[model samples]
Target: MKKAVGIDLGGTYIKAGLVDENGKIIKKQQFPTLAEKNDREIVLTQIEKSIEFAFEDNIEGIGVGTPGVVDDEGIVYEAPNLPCWDKINLKKIFEEKFKKKVVVENDVNTIAWGEYLFGAGKGSKTMICITLGTGLGGGIVKDGKLLRGGKYSAVEIGHIPIDYKGPKCKCGNIGCIERFVGRDYIVERAIKGIREGKKTKIYELVNGDLDKITPKTISDAYNLGDEFAESIWIDVGICLGAMFSGLVNLLNPDTIIIGGGISQAGKILFDTIEKTIKERAMKILSRDLKVVPAGLGIDAGIVSAGALIFQE
Candidate 1:
């Protein structure tokens, strides 16, 4: 069986794996990103070593999923999460180090591609995969192909403006969907509610440590029958559903796959989101549109990264 290397370049860690064509990870390894060091050469060297370790032998090509705007030629224009990745020729570096054909794609796009080929959106012609975590990220597959815009930075659903004058986004936009539904936003809202002395179990859940407030913490509290946490998820689901409605009207895709840590909220989140969509979206577009959770889990990134090379 042919083998490929997939690398998920994250801010805190670099996850690399050797995967076969069937989406099975033959071997996997991880290393700290050490991005704060701000040494591009050192970072690249470390990545190269990690890939080499994962490769071992018989690796045909390499696919990298990075958290940034990657050009078609595999240059990283900018990575907001990693400060040293601006305008870095990641493709050139990897290719030079490994002497193998290398393809670089946006991390979110990688996930979408993975799902379209091996996960929830498999066999769908048009699909949108939304990942709800620390920040909202998305990948759109149209006609079973990744949509690369003029600048190769397409499918940025998170930045879609839901409000023109709402909260300022990290992307310099106002009222972006991410600003409303991302993990930070959820925690911020929860903290604000607690400060207002809203009666809820979140206070005790975090043991009075506001700093410990996280999306998971909120979800856990909600699972334990905390009204405050439950309300936060309800609001999150509503916002996500509202955003998805617009997408459904525009793309009319067969599936909208939701992934990431928060997706574990499961039925509570899905039911609320579906209810909002039913009430807000056009019935014509919403009909037959399936909103489902990603089946790949954390392995999605790794599998998707490898699929990049295998598919080529």
Candidate 2:
């Protein structure tokens, strides 16, 4: 069985694993990214350490999933939280260090490929996957291939604008879907309701500390039978579904996979997204569409990173 070292690089931690070709993780561990130091070399050393931790003599190579826009040659651009990361040739760096073949891709794109191969999207001809959390990231698998641009990982789905005149996103785009559904924005909605005295359990869950309110708090409130909390997830789902409706029209994907922290809202969120997409997208395109949770679970990143190298 062929194996590889997989590295999932994040702002706060680097998750490393030894994975077989079948997408099963044989062993895995986590290391702090130490991105707070804001030194590129420090972060690089951390990644190297992660690679070493997972490396084995018989492994085929290393696969890295990093947060950034990665070009065809594995040159990373616009990496957030990692200082001086722009224009770094990650593939070249790691290959030289480890003396092995290396494959690097944007983290979300890696996840989409993993789902396509071993998770919810396994049997689908076309699939779209997104991770909803502090920020929204997405990838697409079309016709049994991971979609990519001519020279870069181009499926930047989160940056797609839903409203050109609405609030500006952190990416400098106005009214991107992420601006309305990202973590802070979701929490902002709950804060507004509390300030307006809407009388909900969210306030109680946070003990009046508006700053402490999170999507989890809202989920907890909804579990306690709070209608107001349910409203927040519904609105978020609507925002996401509205964006996905456009994607469905353009891509005609058969499956849409949702993951990451906020996806834990479970039934209410998924149901609302499916309902809204059905209502908004073209009937022919939306009819067979299935919105499902990601199948890779908590270790998706590590497994997906390995999948990058094991692609058929």
Candidate 3:
């Protein structure tokens, strides 16, 4: 079988894997991004070293999934987390450095493709995959093709405007989905609820350290039957469902795959999202829609990036 190399580049870590045609990762490794020690050449060198460690004679191609808005032409327009990345042709850099066919895409898009081909959305003709992490992001695959808009920002569900008078996002948009569902906002909501005397275990769990509070704190508290925690997830699900209703109505995908950190909320989170979808979306549009968790977990990025080469 053919083989390829996949790289998932993020702000804190750079991961690389050797993958076979069947989506099995034969080898994988990760390294610190050293972003604080940032230098374009140094960062590229680290990535090169990882790729080289994974390379072998049979490796035919390479694929990368990065944390930014990547054009179809493999240029990173902007990566919010990576302060130095802007209009860089990463594909060219990797290809020239490695002398292999290299392809690069937005990280979320790669995750969606990974799930569609090998994880939750497999066998579906059309699918939408959303990742709820520090930010909200998504991608859509329709009739076996990934959707890339003219600006390579198609299906970027994070910026979908839901409220007119809501808080402004760093992206300069009012009421973007990320403003409501992002990690910072989720924690912010929990903190707000606690300050207002809503009953929850988050404060105690964090040992009175608000800065240490995280999404996991909220999830753990919810599992412990905390009212405030439960409310937060419920509200998140409702907002997500409301935002997704418009997509379902327009795209009519067969399934929706959700990934990233917040997906771990399990039933408390998914049940509400499912219920809201049923309530908000049109009957026919949502009747058979499957709201499923991503099956690959952390490996989704590596596998999907490899898929770019594996499929070719």
Best by lDDT: 2
What is the alpha-carbon lDDT of model 2 when measured against the actual structure? 0.93
Go through the candidates in order and give each one's C-alpha lDDT.
0.87, 0.93, 0.87
Give the local distance difference test score of model 1.
0.87
Residue clash pairs of candidate 2:
none
Q: Tens digits of per-residue lDDT for model 3 on 159-187?
A: 99999899998889899989999999999
Model 3: what TM-score? 0.96
What tens digits encode model 2's per-residue C-alpha lDDT throughout 109-172?
Answer: 9999999988999989999999999989999998888999999998888899999899998888
Residue ranges of candidate 3 with Cα displaced over 4 Å: none
**Candidate 1: where are CA atoms >4 Å away?**
none
Task: Report the number of clashing residue pairs per model.
Answer: 0, 0, 0
Runs off by more than 4 Å, candidate 2: none
Question: For model 3, where is the 10-residue window of minimal lDDT?
Answer: 33-42
